[model samples]
Target: MTPSLPDILVGNFLCMAEPPPPESAGEFMAGKVGVVALLSLLAAQEAERGPSARVWENAAIRAVLTDAAEAYGDAFAEAGAGVDTDFTLGALDRANAALRRSLIALHEAVETAGDVVRDHAILRLYGQMADARRLDMPPLPGR
Candidate 1:
């Protein structure tokens, strides 16, 4: 796969060595620049995907909610619906975590819906959720 230009750029910047000048380039060369550059790159990627990620993620959440709502229509479940797209970073993040947890529940519930087709669909959804949360959460559901 071709590396993203941003990644390539960050990689190049990170590979740069000290100027070998004043010799006073001491602490600054202690990986501080690399760390900051990587963080900046991460922030850039996050910003680029910020809106779309929330949109796609919320749709996933809503799909799960709707599926669960219909499956457990009377199961007294709590759906984390009505997410405001304009929420602050921290708040949106908290909602993201909550939605992820619910995704797990919805995935299992969907699988056990007593229908083969829906069961397969839920299995795929579970896979997608695993892909999305693989970095932060465990790969297995509920683990």
Candidate 2:
């Protein structure tokens, strides 16, 4: 059976990290290896979880926009109505990017209007976005 993308990334990370690189390669090379290994690990996580996380974040942001539309404007309602049937990472990311721009505008509008309730909702959504995108970073070696 063919190995998954995450599995391949893990394999690459192992190959780079094992034997700890040559001592002759010095600190710079070791540092480079560490960086590449970290990237590989992060990429693996994204490969497995990125799409779902983005979808959830997008939906949550849209919900906030929809609810705020009455106080803000119909533009927010229209923005919230957007759908990403493509579901490809790139497509979803594009839709997400646009929605994020709208979200930012809505945030500014709420703050400017002193709409505490909407502002709090937007702030909560921001926290959720950060949590959704958080990486499962492995602890440094030797504690």
Candidate 3:
């Protein structure tokens, strides 16, 4: 049987000692879903409160997101065929890495930004990501 999401995450984390790579069509799809979900949330928040200075002024963040978006597009094109090739998996890995780096920057901004509401929102998103990571690998095994 296929492993549960958390189990897949944990197993990948333990075995690989890094973020889980998309090893199957389902995993690739799940990664895509996560990307879309975070991007959608960011878009909605920006639309409501306008873009944060940290987000707008950070060229690195912009470039990373743009690159990731393009990579995501490329991955999506191949996704229908089930990420069966090394090329497709490599593209997806690049996209995921870009997105993860961007998130780290945003989380750091959350710590320094003075805007209470925006900071809170960013923190919440960071928390969600952290929770996922926690599930990916426990802090102490058998605890």
Top-lDDT candidate index: 2
Per-model C-alpha lDDT, please? 0.59, 0.82, 0.42
Tens-digit lDDT track for model 3 on 1-143? 73333344455445445455557458675665555454444444434333222232232334433443342444322322221123333343444455556656544544565546645654565554444333222243235
Model 2 deviation from the true structure expressed as Cα RMSD, one decimal place: 6.2
Clash count list over all predictions? 0, 0, 0
TM-score of each model, in listed order: 0.55, 0.79, 0.28
After superposition, the stretches of candidate 3 with alpha carbons farther than 4 Å from their true spots are: 1-90, 107-113, 133-143
The sequence of per-residue lDDT tens digits that candidate 1 reaches over residues 7-54 is 655665655653545664777665556565655555566556554555
Ranking the candidates on TM-score from highest down gives 2, 1, 3
Specify the poorest-scoring 10-residue window by lDDT in model 3.
76-85
TM-score of 3: 0.28
Ranking of all candidate structures by their lDDT, best first: 2, 1, 3
lDDT tens per residue, model 2, 9-57: 7777676766754663888777767877787787778877889988998
Q: After superposition, how far is residue 104 of candidate 3 from its true place, in Å?
A: 3.2
